[model samples]
Target: MNFLALLLILKIGLSLALLVRPFMMAPTKALNNVMSLYGDNPLIYRLYSIAILSLCVAYGFGLYEALSGRMPWNVIAFGIVSNAGAALALTALNSHPKLRPFEATFATIAAALVLCALAPNYALMSI
Candidate 1:
């Protein structure tokens, strides 16, 4: 209904999609093979997906609470990590220009969500 809700929807949708990317997009031609080399068995990749999914859920709940303009510590931490990842991706994708937008969008979305969460009307004081 408000800016924070809208941002949460974006974060939730994008994150959920990303978390499922490997499984759904893997065998399909449209799915880029760049990630295939990592294979399906790496315990690390599985852990990574779980973490990403958890972050998404956090964003969803965090933004839900953001209606009061109080950004919780968990949400702030998530934003910091998301922002850091975006910066790293932007740098890492330098050799692959096709990925430029992905990095840029992640940075923008996460930053906006962070700002919206910290706004006066949507904040939570007690963490």
Candidate 2:
């Protein structure tokens, strides 16, 4: 696959992992880590998880469209912007050192998505 396709696949995979993380961590000490990081509000945590899952669904749809040869540039652009904004907001709001790596990784992924969305032809040039 080309770079664009690869990036889309990566995005979908990461989204799936993010969607599953809450469920997988719920019964473990990771939930406690989440509570410590996010606060004692279970509602907030649930809402956050729902938001991530929603984004994941959107990304999945985008990936399907892309693979079908009808790439949805608008959806991809939205994802890039939203992910970048989320990364920036998280970095600004949270000073937790442990979360920095995740924030940076998300920002990097967002940057890659933006590049793919903006210049798919150039991005896929090698193919």
Candidate 3:
């Protein structure tokens, strides 16, 4: 309904999709495509996905608190900063075209989260 809520929904959706992608596309052509670009480190890829999923779950808890007027702004802020830093690092370290879009999307979402977290209308308090 509000900007914060919308951002939370977007975050959940993207995170869930990313969490499921490896399982859904593994052993298929899509996984092959990812492997070709990022190398065939299935373990590393799955671990990365799990890490993203964990972050997403943390954000989900923050969202719940936010909706209840007890938002953990500090945790959310930390996640936003972490996501931004990761995006920058990925952009700098990876020259693969396939990764560019992923990094861009992460940066975009992180920016939106930061903006929403800072918005006066959200009225979040630091933990």
Candidate 4:
């Protein structure tokens, strides 16, 4: 598939993983690692996941439109802003070496998503 479609699918999958991570990690040490950073409360994480999942649905629609040769500028803008913001926010967590691996992985993913969102426009400009 196209680049935008691929990025959107990857993002949707990542968001789905986030939506289930709290529950999936509950019986594992991974949960403890998260708890140490956030808190003892998994509720907050679950809530955040719900929000992300909702956005993922919206992104699905955006992807459909994009594949039809009509780029959804609004969705692209939102993706750029949200992903860039997430990447920036994760950078702050880097100070805690214990969280570096987790933060860096997602931050890198977010940054990639931001770049993906901008890439089409960049290509258009060069044409």
Number of the predicted model whose lDDT against the real structure is largest: 2
Overlapping backbone residue pairs in candidate 2 total 0
The collision pairs in model 4 are none
- How much is the lDDT of residue 122 in candidate 3? 55
Ranking by lDDT: 2, 3, 4, 1
lDDT (Cα atoms) of all candidates against the true structure: 0.62, 0.69, 0.68, 0.64
lDDT of 2 by residue, 1-127 (tens): 4666667677667766754566444643466574345444455556666777777777778766666666668667887887798789878887777667768877988898878767877655545
TM-score-sorted candidate list, best first? 2, 3, 4, 1
Instruction: State TM-scores per candidate.
Output: 0.66, 0.77, 0.74, 0.69
Which ten residues in a row are the worst by lDDT in model 3? 118-127
TM-score of 4: 0.69
Q: Model 4, 19-99: lDDT tens per residue?
A: 455543454345557445545556665667667877888889987876666666777777767766765676754465555
Candidate 4 residues lying further than 4 Å off, grouped into runs, are 18-32, 97-127
Write candidate 3's Cα lDDT for 1-127 as tens digits. 3556556667778767864566434654466575454455466666767777777777778778777666567656876887788789888876767767778877987887777667735545333
lDDT of 3: 0.68
